[model samples]
Target chain A: MIEVEQLSKVYGSTAAIQEVTFAVEPGEILGFLGPNGAGKTTTMRILTGYLPATSGTAKIAGFDVHENSMAVRQRIGYLPETPPLYPDMTVEGFLHFVARIKGVVAGDRAKQVENALTRCNLLEKRQVLIRKLSKGFKQRVGIAQAIVHDPPVIILDEPTVGLDPRQIIDVRNLIKSLAGDHTIILSTHILPEVSMTCSRVAIINRGRVVATNTPEQLMAELAGETGYELEVEGDIALAQARLAALPGVKTVEPIVDSVEGSGEPSRQKLRLSLVTGTDPGREIAAVVVNSGLGLYEMRRTRVSLEKVFLELTTEEKAIDPETMAAAYERASHRDTEPPILPISVTTDQTTDWAPDRTQSIKSDETPIEDETEASITAEQPSRPEEEP
Target chain B: MQSVQILFANLMAIYRRELQSYFASPFAYVIAGVFWLLSGFFFVAILLGPEGLIAQANFRDQLGMTNPPIDVAAQFVSFFLGTLSSLALFILPVLSMGLYAEERKRGTLELLATSPLTNWIVALGKLLGALTFFVTLLLPMLIYQTIALSAANPPAPFTGLLLGHLGLILLAAAVLSLGMFVSSLTDSTILAAILTFALVLFLWVVDLVGNSLVGPVGAGLKHISLIRNYTNFAQGVFDSSSLVVFLSYVMLGLFLTAQSIEAFRFQRS
Candidate 1:
């Protein structure tokens, strides 16, 4: 129902989206997944004929979006990020107005509006003014207006951003029911929303499509990169050595035991994580038991979609030396300003395992202040150390 | 035929919605009320004040110089319409400020642009809707004129009265069309209103600049001054040139507004 080919949009010098290509089958719901400012909305706007791409073309229902915008718009329904609602209008009034503008015949307008209201579960609130509706109902009204004319394609931008959990589920089920009749492309930053609601997922970042596949296929591809977590009471070194000796085992790393005050000196509890190409649970279990170690827990930790998402999005590579030096200089210059908070307070507030240099740097600054009253003393020497 | 029908349907849909929106808020009511109060004050003061035209006519008769037979009705209508034209300078901007600016601010312009309806349909619907409300605001003042004219021994010339009102309508249509164009240029309604006022004030006083100039430039400025064309109509003179001028201004404003909206669509694209 929708085909986008090498779509590129450049605003002045910055590319809002570049070479974005995706397709939605006649009955499929394609999840446009991306973080904020990742060009998802920009791509949707182009597809819906609300914006013109600087290069490339998009076809909807076999009509070019730019060349035949009116025809394309007639076949598509769009719910912009803010719902594009008139607060003074009642839900029914607004839907009827949209239906008319969308070119629904006068005879079918009322019936189509009623169908949309019922489908979105807005029949009860049809008579209520939209401004009086809650955020969730307002979102439902937005969806209702989109479907009022029964268009073949529906494009929604973050349709569930402000809804409650129950409303989200309701909306998800509503979108699910829309399949087989209407093709959908919904953009969202929520991972589970895509996993649960979309048939195929396209992950975009920095104006580029990085990955596109079914959720299951994406998970399966990353399955080999997953590791396992094991809890055992044994000689930690022997278990580590034995687990490393397994054929498929990549490496064995022992995790700290988090149990409090068990007071069993002879029995050392260790968590062993094994990075393997495949599930090595059976071989590792047999080895641990035969080696005379207590095997309290053994389970395969499957990789989740969240982990896959993070892996695909957050893998930063090497930077060139010139750019690296420029970044370092910028960081060092940023360090001269007085800290927004006291140094001791910031050091105490460290939630991560990184070192605290607040005290040592303060000690270093004390000598400089004493040596020369004319010298510009740094307010906190520790601040520079905090720069990466 | 079918395409024309669809276009009409779309225009009607937008027009109805816009008209309903105007009455749905207190903004329209406040504007109408202020307009009626100010226009009512001018109407009464012109007819009944001690120094008004009626009082001056009576004083002239007592002095035995009423041989030419002063036409109080004609003088009253002309002066009344003159006051209305001035009042339109202030009232029309308030009527038109929200036409496009409010839609842009509230983000509903996205819906309209992405719909199958064209930009001209949207702009015309809004213009007609505002014009209808302006007419409604003028309706009550018409009642005051009817009462005052009926009490006179000799009734006012109905043709002159009709011509005067037709002139007022044309002048108002011209002003509102320009104001609507200004509204389309910005999303800030206050900025639209203030900018429109400045532009209208400039045109209102363009004749002064024309008076200062010595040649064709002065003639051109005088021809374009909005008040110059309006004065002929207010005097019950059916000047085709003035009518053409007023129509030209209206068309110019409408054309610019449509282009402004089209430009906005291009910018968004």
Candidate 2:
């Protein structure tokens, strides 16, 4: 129901959103996931016809948001970050006013306003002045005003912002209930909101869309490459060398490097992140046994959605040539010395907290060549595989 | 025809909301109360005070010096309207200051801007709403003026009274329209009111500056002075040119307001 193509908004010298392209299918709730200042609000505003895009076009129900703004506006509902409410007016009065301007017929205006108030659980507060309502109620009134006309497309910018936990859940549920009939796009910095509420997620960072997919698919794509953690006694270097030699093993590093000077030099905790679809569990155990290492504990773990989000948003994928060469030298030199884990290697017991796994995996990558060459030669393997 | 109906419906919705807000606000009532107190005081003072028009006229009658045929009722109507218009000069700015600024302040401008209703439609609705409220402010004064004029020996001509009040309304509409434009330029109602006051004050007295100068430039300034045009109607002169100037101010204010809002859509901030 909505198509945004190469949309960009340049403010003086800074670009608020650059080449932002995303689409929401009919009846689908597309969660616009991004960190603060990630151009999510800018994109939402452009799509809602509230602000004119510097370039490109947004269309709702086949009408360009800029060229046919009135038609697009008639078809869409928008709730800005601050709920556009008249504080002096009652809840029902505000909704009726919204319905009128949104082009609801006079005969149906009261019914539609009532319908919105009921949907938002605001029936009890209909006669209450808006300024007298609580923050959550005001937010509900904001939502009611947006949906009063029963528009097909709804764009909300951080709709659940300032609400308490219960109110947030209520608003989220309200938004979810709105999904089947209205094509909904909600922008938020909250990660769990997207995973719980949106059917498909579009993760934007630094004015660019880094990835877009269903939440399950995004986590599954990152979790596809399984990781293993092990505690071993006896020559740690030898066991790591053997594991790194395995075809599918991607990186091998000491999990607890802070314990290096504290004792247990002979005993170490190590983690191995493998290439996609390659477990190598049996071979890994065999390698450790043959290397005369006492294998204490072996546990398999999967990447969570939080890790996928952090990887896509926070990882500095584009390494400068100097940092790359320095990282390459460090990687090659580490082969000779005892494996002190790179700072990027998260020391968490499981991969659940490994937000910087991409950096750590790249630094400890085997053969040294893939470490430097793969970054510049092709797309980073750690990048989230997004739909075209 | 259907489009016109929709437009009217939308306009009424906006207008009714604006009017309702004013009726609900204590601040608007305070403004009205102060206006009534001040205007009521001046109404009685102008008619019955020691140096008032009636006292001076009666004294003139005692002296038997009716040379210019002074019509006391006409004189009182014009003088009272002049005072009311001056009172309006202060009060109208406060009234119009919140027309768009308050919307911007409360963030409801986003709702109006994104809606299917056009910019000019919203501006016109707000103007009509504010103008209607201004009319209500005059209703009490209208009653007193009618009673006071009923005692005239040669009852005040209805046309002259209508024309004089019409002049006051036009002057008010002109001021409120311009104030609305100024209000749209800022989110701070205080700043909007101050700026509008500064603007209207200049237009009110431009003729003083115009009198000192000579040639077409001077004539042009005097011709455009709001008070000068208003005085023509207050004195019961139906000048089409003055009507055009008043209408132009109203149209100009509305047009400029629409343009200001349109430009706001593209503003980076």
lDDT for every model? 0.76, 0.80
Ten-residue region with minimum lDDT total, candidate 2 chain A: A338-347
Where does candidate 2 chain B have its weakest 10-residue lDDT segment?
Answer: B153-162
**Candidate 1 on B131-200: residue-level lDDT in tens?**
8888888888887887787777786766777788888888888888899899999999999999988988
**Per-model TM-score of chain A alone?**
0.66, 0.72
Candidate 1, residues A44-75, lDDT tens digits: the string is 98998778899998999999999999999999
Q: Write the per-residue lDDT of candidate 2 for residues B187-217, one digit (tens) a residue.
A: 9999999999999999999999999999988
Q: What DockQ score does model 1 reach against the true complex?
A: 0.56
Q: What is the TM-score of each candidate against the true structure?
A: 0.80, 0.84
lDDT of 2 by residue, A1-388 (tens): 8998999999999999888888889999999876567788889888878899999888999999999999999998999999999989999988988998999998999899989989999999999999999999999998998899999999898898778667877998899999999999998755556767889988776576766788666555554656676778988888888889998888888865533323666778888877777778888888888888887667664433333343323223442434333333333332233222221223233332322243322212222243234334334333322111
Error of 2 at B262 (Å): 1.3
Classified by CAPRI criteria, candidate 1 counts as: medium
In TM-score terms, candidate 1 sits at: 0.80
